[model samples]
Target: MSDMRGEVILRVVPRPADINSNGHIFGGWVLSQMDIAGGIVAGRIAKGAVATVAIESMKFISPILLGDLVSVYAHAERRGRTSVAIRIDVVATRGGGAETVDLTSGVFTFVALDENHRPRLLPDA
Candidate 1:
């Protein structure tokens, strides 16, 4: 799926190590990658460090096998006083085809943190 209304924050192709025995990408790997992507956007929004507080609505819709290039995109869906709600999407593509399939999707929440690790208010979204 394409985010015509938003911006792309992260794009990556999955490697063999990213696949699980079930022939799909490992859930942890996907989550971690998404977390990294969220941090990228969150840091820019916070103008400093940010910590992941919660991840919700995580749902796997399809499978991703070895050699399947998975592209993950993230964007800020909404903003709160000290937090930002981010929507992340995973897309997979095979060499035989030119199209990409939506594998999974979810929203992540993070809190802006100061240099001393205390929670700080984020800038406007």
Candidate 2:
């Protein structure tokens, strides 16, 4: 199912190794997906490379299970001279795509990077 959260930046499925003893996907795995999604949006907005500087806020609303199609959505929420804040939301579709669960949501800040790996001013919007 489509959501109005933002652009669907990444879609993936968790592997068996990504699960914890509780049979749910590890939080780190989910966080990594969000970071990847945020970076993609940030890079597009910056028109160059970008690095994740910080996670302003994050909340895990539900667990992810194996065989679920995970979708990570992201959008630029705020922009600065050299940094942009991307709001990311993750959802898991399960039960043969009948149910969708909100897995996590966060706002990640990314800094535009130059060839020297240092922060650079973002491009015009």
Candidate 3:
């Protein structure tokens, strides 16, 4: 995915413990990273608290290996009365030459919430 798709929201290096028995980063770990990135973008658009309602789509394009530098990018793809769909793409930079690879991509929906924890209307963009 291009940087035009979204801003880089999160970046971190996976520790050894983050790897699965297969010697690749766990899918759940990557999913959590995407969720976090989606929530950040969604909350900013909503201008308040937001809760993840669903993962509309997800695709693991490539494996994230140990020592890979992972970066998660996200942008709001769509917005409803109280929910926003965030498209998140993850890229991994590995090896000494700084080769980049697309690792995963997903679309997640989050609902804006009021202090009462009920869904609230999203603020105007």
Candidate 4:
């Protein structure tokens, strides 16, 4: 939220159907977006296929509103021989884009995969 640390990987507007009973966007929906964003970065770092293996941590800072323009940001936080941990952050722009709200943040770990879908070493960086 403070000077957004990662690249904006995805930008989307929530639909009515994405809302929960509380009139806020579902947490699962936000989480999925985060995963997608993280996967993109992880795949780039791995230089091939990657699969989410774990979520090291997640925090929901605020609820997403129907009219908010959601932006997913991500960056590789750490890397191992076969896996990378991506830091993903979700922010919402509302009030005719005059306001920005910090929605959620998480660290998702992804493992590089080979053609056989088995874990593989990441490409040299």
| Model 4 agreement with the true structure over 26-106: per-residue lDDT tens digits | 999999999999999998998899999999999999999999999998988889999999989899999998999989999
Clashing pairs in 3: none
Clashing pairs for model 1 are none
lDDT string for model 1 (4-53, tens) is: 42556666777777878887778898889889988888788888899999
Q: Give me candidate 1's TM-score against the actual structure.
A: 0.88
Which digits, one per residue and each the tens of the lDDT, describe model 3 over residues 7-125?
99999998988989899999999999999999999999999999999998999999999988899999989899999999999999989646999999989999999999999999887
| TM-score of every model versus the real structure | 0.88, 0.95, 0.95, 0.96
lDDT of 2 at 106: 95
Candidate 4 total steric clashes = 0
Clashing pairs in 2: none
For model 1, what is the C-alpha lDDT against the true structure? 0.81
lDDT for model 3: 0.92
Off by over 4 Å in 3: none
Model 3 earns a TM-score of: 0.95
- Compared with the true structure, what per-residue lDDT tens digits does model 2 show for residues 1-125? 24458889999999999999899999999999999889999989999999999999999999899999999988889999999999999999999989988989999999999999999999889
lDDT of each: 0.81, 0.93, 0.92, 0.93
